[model samples]
Target: MVLVTAPLIGFSGEIIWPIGQILLPVKIGDAEHSTSTWMNFVVVRSPSLYNEIIGRPGVRKIQAVPSTAHRMLKFPVLGGILTLRKQTIAIGSTLIEEGWRALCGLLRRNLDIFALKLEDMTGFSRHIAEHRLNVREGCSLVRQKKRSQAPKRNKAIQEEVEKLVDAGLMKEVHYHS
Candidate 1:
């Protein structure tokens, strides 16, 4: 069975787990009584297909695929815009995984193009690129420091801050109210 895991988000902007399991039904159920025993596995299928199946007593691990349709619908508008602009947006189960992989691949392949576009649009010269790179490097350093729980590299951070200040990207702050 194909298994895909993803972080689940609900209607109220909260994250939840909604695992989907695709399996064949062994025993049949009628309109009035709806319960089944599949391959010695007993399950109580709900009236609404959209509702999650809560495991009953004696049931162990339940295999599931991430619900792609519900997830896509729950994403914020900015995420939708990003997906739409990529030309690899897919809605259904068959294409959803492939679409996301393609989108990531496209972005990975076009990093230089994106950088050039940003530089051109912002009217930043080569000197400005160096400053931007410095700022990015410093940010990475700070992130590494935070992750490692180590003391800050004040000298290197100060140097990068000065570079950014010279490039007009940042200004010195004396105090905050």
Candidate 2:
């Protein structure tokens, strides 16, 4: 990889010179359902809350749709749609609290507002808001070929899926041909 000085603007309106750039293969989702794409990552010397940030190009390559309201990311896979859910809530770093007690009391009082666990979820709805994917004229949906897995891996996958079904996070559905 060749070293290049790339200037990037920060969120705070500060200009930064990147240390280097490298092309890497980034894969998202699990083994059964996933997509891979080669991305050019710019190494920077700065402090950030996030470890790595995938810009719009990387997301477009994976064809992922992220929803802040739903707190999840969805994308098309071989068999069906793959969804990734956010487990933790984001707290503003600028938030001022009197002390730990005040912060704890505030969170305690609003415990019902956040879904901290599977048990905290009240219900599930397929339709949260109106959303549509615009397909270009004459463009066709590409069918992905299913990859075969080892017997042990398949059994482990099935067990993990059953756990999700039991937790009300996933359910088996029969699609009519």
Candidate 3:
């Protein structure tokens, strides 16, 4: 997820939003099918507030089965080999599997995506805030009073931020009156 979010920086060169750093496992199938296909799984992640803040959205369909007793019905594996269930087939040169192609195209055609490295920026301008606090004293480790920055961003930068917000890459935070 972090690898994915690394490229979502807007025109101002800041991360659109933070994302979960991991992909979650999705289990498939229910009681009747469970015994037959026990090892089904998918690499998936839940859409979060950050994802909403950004442009991408996702949905999950869970396979839920009610409690029921199974009789003696069972499935038997028929293949000694070449079974689809156990076979790991590699789909060659598809969009996802061939990231190099997509990256090359992006580099050649839309360099702006690479130009604004979100990870290099200090912060984002939209749906965001920053607070500075001082630490001091012997063993106190207490935080000093916070200092607030000007609520208004530069007009040009704000315009860029608005563009990203309009594109559904960020939420409008109403922290200021």
Q: TM-score for each prediction? A: 0.21, 0.47, 0.19
- Give per-residue CA lDDT, model 3, range 1-177, as digits (tens): 334334344322333443434444432223223212222222124332232221112111222222112111122223321101111111123234346555566557744223243233332322222222333444445456965545564664577667645644446543221
Clashing residue pairs found in predicted model 1: 20-64, 20-65
Runs in model 1 with CA error above 4 Å?
Answer: 1-108, 112-152, 174-176
Error of 2 at 151 (Å): 52
Write candidate 2's Cα lDDT for 5-118 as tens digits.
659975434577888888988666765677678998888887665557778887788788977567577878778888876433233343344444565686687564556656
Model 2 root mean square deviation, Cα atoms: 14.2
Model 2, position 89, has a per-residue lDDT of 22
Worst 10 residues of 3 by lDDT: 81-90
**CA RMSD per model (angstroms):** 21.3, 14.2, 18.9
Which pairs of residues collide in candidate 2?
Answer: none
| Model 2 TM-score on a 0 to 1 scale | 0.47
Ranking by lDDT: 2, 1, 3
The TM-score ranking, best first, is 2, 1, 3
Report lDDT (CA) for all predictions: 0.34, 0.65, 0.32
lDDT of residue 44 for candidate 1: 28
